[model samples]
Target: MATSAATPHNKIIGQRELVVIVALLMSLNALAIDAMLPALGQMAAELNVQDGNRRQLVVAVYLLANGLGCLLPGSLADRFGRRPVLFVSLAAYAACSLLIAAIHSFEVLLALRGIQGVLCAGLMVVPTAIIRDQYEGDKMARLMSLVSAVFITVPVIAPSLGQGVLLFAGWRWIFILFAVVAAVTGLWVWLRLPETLHPENRQRVELPVVLRNMRTGLLNRGAIGYVLGAGLLVGAVFGYVNSAQQLLGEHFGVGEWFPLVFGGTAAMMAVSNIVNSRIVERFGARRVSHAGVLTFIVVSAAQVWAAHYRPGELAVFLPLMATNLMLLGFLGANFGSIAMQPFARIAGAASSVQTFCRMFGAAVVGLLIGQAYDGSARPFAHALLMCSVSALVLVLFSEKGRLFRRLNPPRQQQPAGPPPV
Candidate 1:
């Protein structure tokens, strides 16, 4: 397929430019979450946070806010436009970051962090809706894969960046750094990104209409299954992220090198993302995603068993951790594509609802697992086992109780190629 002719405002910005823009916007969530990892301990100390385990709440609250944020913006973008919603959300995110920087008490910090998470939800939902507005099938997968590849780097570098700021300035500067990045990104979007949703395609924002669309989306058997499955997958990842610093630093005594170790694991995820991008076109998104989910379950189960017997060995843990992270690369992109496939006509509303389910569902699961933290790797392993089993069950239900059967059966495979953007 030839590229579409550029719009007047997009004369200099081709598909590549649009992909980068969407990727950057989507990456805000990752950067916010990952960047805070190194600063978690320091923030706890500075805010005089009483409970050692409660520090994880700083991260969990933000994710919970993000889940809540996804619901309203989808309808808003459908009514107003993607550009306006995005601009407003980014600006709000910047303001929240600044407020977070100024907070002294842990309770206030938690509230502000939740606000930031909610603001960040717009960044995640709108970009995919925008992409659906312009492209579909393999092209959408390619663009998303490319974006995932780029977005994965945020985790790779974010902890290192946070650690550097903490070492030099203070924990407060982490929020300052987030503010600066959000402002720059907001300005870029305000100037460069065009409104993809035309007036005719825009849906009315009446409460009744929004509710009908959301209800319709949820009622679709395929949509519900994929959304819940994706949520469970994300819950697994969040569970790991919430405890990673503690596992690496306190348990393993990596201490100062914790960020580097975490970053390296993140880099492996990026590598798997690249691999997924390459293979998705040839094998098809459904086949690849289903296989990946099964693989993840097996790997997670192995980790649980190993932890039970060899709780003290890094050798027993590190490889499984890397494998689990790598599997997420596969799950993240394909699950989104699969869930959206059935709802492309009402992409905005569908994206919003599915995103809300995934983020909020994950937040709830992650928070529950986090509260069970017992100052050891037990919480992490148990969480993974629970998530993997739950996700596998959801996957089965999503496929109409067909466990391990193909979601989309493979036809003759397409030639392995770069995804269309």
Candidate 2:
């Protein structure tokens, strides 16, 4: 198939609308996860869940399914086009969210949440591919950072939103809100989003063809390491989220202040991403992220000490943890853009595979961290340090022991070649 020309409608989408639309699409995933945090205890108790750690399954199960679900949409989007695929997903996602709200059985609820996760996977994969269709290199990093800056606000406010809903109605209303948001966003995309995948790039959605594209993406030296490293680091964030309610609410006895405390760290992340969007084009993604990770490791080490030495002190723990999360704002967008740099031709499949690795891996690590809760922040802090050090190691391996060296300008849709055995 030869490449198709973009429609005149594509030109009508100004950059500001594009950024907001993309950010809202991505924020759907964040909102679904974060908004449920305040309601976890009530949901668990009502559903007859006895174990505290198991309450996290409300989240962990969704995350695991979300990651696994990412495997299909990209390849399908590559074949069918981004617009149709996304529309189907958004519709199903809204329906699924409503179904989860109306269900009473725990088993049925988990199954519904799993179904919703799979539907929402397209939310994660398609918008990312849409962004890649428009930008690359440091410019791509800058755009992603801006998207992230906007998207980060959902996590910052979602818990508080959930808490407010809990005060007025049952936890089920939270899912009702999710459905409303999905419907509204879906309408916006239907009205505004043009198909981004070129006709020439459309490939057969055959099993073998999809596997081959994914295999090629995973084999790229320039991308694979960052994919893996980013997954490891992102695991730390997931861990914090999984443990946050227990850590701040019960362990530290912050009680109703959990949402405020949670929002503070997320607010810092939003600021950091805003700064990164402004600076990444000038400094290069490599230099900025390398410095960010090094700083992350240092702050994480201090976090470990604080958790142990000042174990009961909320004043000491909050600021250090906030700084660590703030650093993640620098790491996520840059690492993601660099990983996607070599996959211009297969952005859909590439995005799907990389997202699967990052999300599934992070979900499992987060589940472990959540289950490890023992009324102190030491385990969480230690996990963060371990993940950061391991991430730096993988990054070094990816760069062949180099750090802060500038990546060459973007190439044509070509492979970055295979890594050494």
Name the top TM-score candidate: 2
Clash number for each model: 0, 0
Cα lDDT tens digits for candidate 1, 230-269: 7887887787788777877887678899888898888887
**115 Cα displacement, candidate 2 (Å):** 1.6
Alpha-carbon deviation at 162 in model 2, angstroms: 0.6
Task: Give the Å shift of residue 381 in candidate 2.
Answer: 0.9
Every candidate's CA RMSD: 5.4, 3.4
lDDT of 2 by residue, 1-421 (tens): 1123654255457777888999999899899999999999999989899988888888888888888898999988887888877888888878988888988899999888888888779988988898888889999899999999999999999999999999999999999999899899998988877777877677677777788788876767878888888888888888889889899999888999999999988999899999999999999999999999999999999999999999979999989989988999999999999988888888988999999988888888888888888889999999999999999998898899999999786565542233111
Query: For each candidate, what is the lDDT?
Result: 0.78, 0.87
Lowest-scoring 10 consecutive residues by lDDT in candidate 2? 412-421
Best by lDDT: 2
What residue runs in model 2 are displaced by over 4 Å at the alpha carbon?
1-11, 413-421
